[model samples]
Target: MAKHYALASYADGGDWRETEHLYVPRRDTRLRLQSLMALGYTASEVAAATGLSPSHVCNLRTDVVHTTVHVFTADAVASAFRDRWDKLATGPQANRQRSKARRLGYLLPLEWEPGDVDTDDTTEMFLSDPSSPETTENPEVLDYVAIAEAIAGRRVTLTRAELSHAIVTLQDMGVGVHETAERLHTYTRLVNRYRARARQDAA
Candidate 1:
């Protein structure tokens, strides 16, 4: 008997029916899930990329996410593996994160005076790499606590509704609210102000 046996049935007059089952590798997909989880991708993100439902992806946990028969199509799994591989192998994030200090290189040129005679200087210099600017601790969320503290210190005032509305706007822009608020502590407030100013300028 062959190791790769497929079921078949034969009828009269050379009529026959057969079921072919392709060999699928017996690899654990949960390990892949764990790796992606470590990279901070949510199950929804994985499902979106692999065409799986969010619940299906959520159930991919080998233990808490589930250890039962949560099988996905081999094609979907393979596509996910390839996508991860490509992301790891290419693009801007291929380089490691730069330090906060190094990212603020734009401030260096501001120190030069009017009589600086370096027009012929061949040495390459950059104020700061605009591609990777210095982040003041939080880049995504405006620091509300800090803003509140500052406002208190400076006697600035805005209604609670206004503040909450601004925060809600951030959440609508793919930010996870509270967490991004913390991560973007200072900038969130600045962003709202900047956006409002831009709208005013446009108007």
Candidate 2:
């Protein structure tokens, strides 16, 4: 039977010793580690990528070590596996598995690899073709920030702490708390939108 591990997260990070997520051995774990190794990743490399110790990775290859690890650690390992599987997989089974993993948020890395590609001819065609945006400009839409900021005057930058202070200071004058919060939220959102657009245009 496949071993099950329970990994739980906490708001504040703590020592692993404080948690139940640690090695407990099983056959399925060994097979899983071995399979990943067969795909050309060294235990050390995989360990680094997955936030695991090399010894943990190595033991999983030979020992049946299993455990309820932290969700963050499991996520790191899942991400590493997804990238390697997508990059080196040789069959439909691997492709299907990779697709499922991707849907679960284990996305492949964006880097281009010219040497070895396990994907089909369509991938090759895509890589060979010079990449260009399908359309230059986005469909004309109302610029919410532009309209808001034009009426509100040019945006003034403030640190988060400064913004918080401003909100509290305004409330000290007996302004309605809910209205103040709403106005501050709208102001910050519009300012951020304009700043983001400026950066995009500069880029």
Model 1, range 1-203, lDDT digits (tens) per residue? 32333221111122332323334332334444444443345567678877888786655533444333322343454346433421211223322211221242211122323333122111111122212223122334555655455333232222323333344455456665334334433223333443454455459
Q: TM per model? A: 0.28, 0.29
* Runs off by more than 4 Å, candidate 2: 1-29, 65-73, 89-203
Best-matching candidate per lDDT: 2
Which regions in candidate 1 have their CA more than 4 angstroms from the true location? 1-27, 63-72, 86-203
> Candidate 2: lDDT over CA atoms?
0.42
Q: Quick one: how many clashes does candidate 2 have?
A: 4
Report the C-alpha lDDT of model 2 over 1-203, residue by residue, as the tens digit.
44444332221222232334344324323433454554435667778777789897776555423534344554445445544532234343544544554453332322234433334322242233222232122324434444344223333343333333344444455555445434443233223333444445459
